[model samples]
Target: MNALQFIETSIEDGIGYIFLNRPKQLNALNRKMVREIVTSMEAFDLDPQVKVILLTGNGKAFSAGADIDEMANDNPINLELTNQFADWDRISLVKKPVIGAVKSFVFGGGFELALSCDFLIAASDTQFSFPEVTLGVMPGAGGTQRLTKLVGKMKALEWILSAERINAKTALQYGFINKIVAPELLMEESVDFARKIAKQPPLAVRLIKESVNKAVDLSLYEGMQFERKNFYILFASEDQKEGMKAFIEKRKPKFTGG
Candidate 1:
């Protein structure tokens, strides 16, 4: 927040962009870097201009993993006292649609960070893994929980326990990622997708995001109840009326986030 040493934030059109800045270290997430990312997203959530947030790394790899040098000498007491993993949870609290446009390597904490986004678009060459077991550590930042929900318990166990890297194609087949573009198309396709979402009815988009995320934590019946409540609540919004009216009129709906 104070100078953004580990990350860079920007706003373009209606998208809030966060670029992991430590390319030389493959954007390895240190405590400070993760904090910077969460703080930037918090700021963007408050800003009216930012309708969507796209996260990408500055260089080839999205992120290699956590900074080994920073935590190798740490103990459990210090770890709990620091509560580093808590920062990862903050990402889910963000209201807007968050899209991860990751490339090359996304491993360990990096893979956890990607899963924190509402969805991901990765490069065809990207390789994802939770290689923490190799280091005698395991994912501490919702990686186990989220990956299990997305890819199922068996696949999660296969990948995490085996410490095997998952290619983009296999990841898409498992439904862990939304899409895979060529390495050259990663940014362009990411922005194109973000821009399309940005043009939608903002309030509806926000509510639907909340509803879908609830599907992950709530039982099927409870999730449907939540979705129904949101659907009814949208009837009170001006955009809801405009969207329907525009449909009847066969014209584009103009949304003002009302």
Candidate 2:
């Protein structure tokens, strides 16, 4: 596997973990880090051995947002650079699920990165915000859109406009994060959760994620049609038959991701 200077990638027990390694800068997302992350995710997506992905950071923060030093420079931000923010979007669209284990700070691009994941397990000490307004800019990534989908439009607007840091408890209340554990146990619990997911039928999980994500933006009729299509498609898959037969035989299904 190719090494990422700003990140670390490893696969164990079918769970692929991509850790932000820039502890010195609080794991802030800069051009290099973002590029590295994109590369890592793409590698994981292509690796059929990887059933799930877990994203986290190594330092005191999950990520302190974008690197302010880059933004402070006089160099113009080009369309290509701005488009790099879609890395998380591509991760979100991957067939395998990505889980975000957040701790410390998750702000700006960091927040969006977590939001891209299908599931989020945050530490109790996690602090989230959309502080781009304070930076004299707005979220150039999918923050504006993804935030509103995770939370409501009003709450998303409040967080962005007020630039208030929300604690993990408040975030859970608003449904921004799925679960919160102690900071000390964040990684352990995240890996445990990913393992549970990995134990399930891979093809089923992939179809479920695809159907749910697509259903959200689609109309009721369209959503139902989409679900029907996926349901039948999966029904014909070898994994589906094996899953049913295994249940009948009172044994755990050994899915080959067929």
Candidate 3:
């Protein structure tokens, strides 16, 4: 499906590709652009053909962050009307797994967007930071919360306070990014990896995503209960029965997402 502007979306091999298409602006996200991205993601989440999503950008940068020009001219009325970050919040509600293929700069809002993804595979030279502090503001999206949860409180504090840009290697060491590849191979590697994930049972995959994401907000015991319930629910799916039967029969299981 085509978004009105800023997003280019396509589906292939069970993988949905969501591209930030504002190359001239380094894919900087204005409100409209952010809305397009959220809308595309929600659409992909509901598309039975799409089991995974690959989010990336089409330019020197994955995204420079929010459109500073748009923010600069905002009045109280327009700011209230825009809802600031209400649309961006919808990204986390996506049930399908979203993998971020990040290159160049992923700053402020861009970093927040990447953090919303289930995992991030970045180019070796990718640089990440939260530069909003420099703008006399702070990350208005999920950056502060998600980054802190991923990298821990001390590191998140340091990064956000200093607005220091870290290379992919450093990000990997900090446990923020999953993998790093050559710039030329970023898309190929990311899509290949996502396709692998797409091969899994779709129902189980969605439940697993929900179970794991709940850990951040739930206590250990509560998280375990949530996991157990999802585990029990999966047994009702035909895929689960087929998977077990296939294992006993020494054959591959064909999942129908039921």
Candidate 4:
């Protein structure tokens, strides 16, 4: 794995952190940056040592959106050849739990990125929007599909069409962001939360995330069947046996991602 220029990555105590590093650009998603992000996610997801993946930015804004400067070219041939949006889609396929630690601005593509995560902990001052309508295009990523599934049709339509910004409070009220913390506590709280999740039985955690995500696209009956199958399969894992034994023994279970 080569060092990434557009993103900073580190793993500590079972948690992997991927920070958007282009502070000068408000951590905007460009081709290079998005590719680096997808690469980092793939690496972390495959690493048995990493139990959870935490994503955030190093600047005032999580990201202002896609690199509008590059979007201005409007070359369809170039866009297809680059396969830009496909790389962004790869983030969703990562099987590990992903948590978003957001602050300031999370707009357009940035908003979609956050939605891709299993959950998000955001700063109270965070501002989210999908301003692609104003750009004469729509969110080319999964924003339209994910946002509608998340916040309902009316709210999704209002935000996407109007391109208005919603503060963290509103976003939480609308059931998107999981929690809001003071800006100073953002990183600490997010990491602490990730660490707590990292302490869980790894196989159970991954299956839980996978099952819930599948529920989004599946009918209630189908989803329940899938959930039941996953639940049954976990009983066959060593971690599950240890977890149950620990409960009976009144001790913390040491899970080795088995």
Candidate 5:
């Protein structure tokens, strides 16, 4: 826990929960919190029992971005800050799928954090924005790249330049959120989704995530070649055989993560 000062972690039913615990600060991302998040994610990746990870907040806001107090007088644009942003890029590359259970405000760094996840479940009232421009800065996190990929260049540019807040429904329309649930059902729905995914073969899930992520940056032909390589690798796994056999036998496949 020393790695993060404003977050709490818990694991159960093959899901790892990472909670932003700084309610007083609206779950702001400070230096300590970011370090803690990265450390916790590393632990989750190594834990055999954890099949999925959930990122959420403890109170009203999911996260309001960075702690303005810390950056108030310092040089905000520099290599050090850029490295801090790359930490999130690392999070997005974790093999296990991550789900963002977002509610209330998810702005700037918070928005970037949600974007890092493989999927997002947002509350009906949740608000998202890239208000960094209003602060006389830009989203230094993976926002610049990830948001463009998710919502397309035009919409991403409009949102970033306008620094306007969009409602959950609008986010869904723009393909920014995977699903929208009522506030009270956000956690339950997200956990339910995680459970369904966890029941699938773990090795297949890992390979699929890796293949898709790697393919996005490659040419269509190169991406298909990468997919074929992963497909063949998966075909050689015992889990793949078991999966097919179980389906033919109308039985549940007990994956061993092999």
Candidate 6:
């Protein structure tokens, strides 16, 4: 594949990495950058070697937000013609987990992009906000929905309406960010987390991810049924047999994603 202009892609230890590469522009989510992100993620989804995907910024800020200069003059018709949001939707369709390791100024679309991940690990200095309201707009991405689902309407509205910068600790308190580490240790900790999950049985990992994401939208009964079905389905997998047999033999299980 040709070298990407807006992002960098790499694979290591069963983890696929997407680094938002526009550092000087604060890694803003522009059309080209978003396309690269979607394309890389789709590629990783198809690659058997990639068990997990990690998304983070390449520089000082994860992202300042989307490219305002590119969108400032847009109207409904132009937006409709582009169908710009379809690219964002592609992130959710990915079968493998995508972890967001973010820091610094994660605002507006950056905050929304982070939410698109399966989970997040942030640096202690990270600050998140949905400042689209300040521009007489609102979060066109998942911010309003995911954030509200995360911390409830009260906190979501408070932050969105005020455009308040919610610090890392507060975000942790709200239960959006999975963990926060020292700025210098951010990448190390996040990669370690990804590697840990990558070591799990790949079939189980994929099913578990599918079950959990379904929990967000499905009713409790439907979600439980979905989970139960998956639980039963795993018994038919070779990894499940290996896992139990290894436990009985007091030996480590080796899973081949079968």
In terms of lDDT, the best-performing candidate is 1
* Per-residue lDDT over 23-58 for candidate 3, one digit per residue giving the tens place of the 0 to 100 score: 999899888888888889999999999999999999
- Candidate 4 — which pairs collide? none
Q: How far out, in Å, is residue 126 in model 3?
A: 0.2
What is the Cα-based TM-score of model 1? 0.98
TM-score winner between candidates 3 and 5: 3
Candidate 4 matches the true fold with a TM-score of 0.97
> Model 1 over residues 103-193: C-alpha lDDT tens digits?
9999999999999998799999999999999999899999889999987899999999999999999999999899999999999999999
Regarding TM-score, does 1 or 3 come out ahead?
Answer: 1
TM-score for each predicted model, relative to the true structure:
0.98, 0.94, 0.97, 0.97, 0.95, 0.98
RMSD of 4: 1.1
lDDT of 1 at 233: 98
Quantify all predictions' global Cα lDDT against the true fold. Answer: 0.95, 0.87, 0.92, 0.93, 0.88, 0.94
* Residue 22 lDDT in candidate 2: 90
lDDT of 5 at 245: 93
- Cα lDDT tens digits, model 6, 1-258, are 557999999999999999999999999999988989999999999999999999999999999999999999999999999998899999999999999999999999999999999979999999999989889999997889999988999999899999999999999998999999999999999999999999999889988999999998999999999999999999999999999999999999998899
Per-residue lDDT tens digits for candidate 5, residues 84-153, read 6666667866899888999999998899888888899999989999999998888888787889988789
- The sequence of per-residue lDDT tens digits that candidate 2 reaches over residues 139-165 is 978888989987888999998999999
Our tally of clashes for model 5 stands at 2
Tell me the lDDT of model 5 at 25. 87
Which parts of model 6 have CA positions greater than 4 angstroms off? none
Better of 1 and 4 by TM-score: 1
- Candidate 1 error regions (>4 Å): none
- Order the numbered candidates by lDDT, best leading: 1, 6, 4, 3, 5, 2
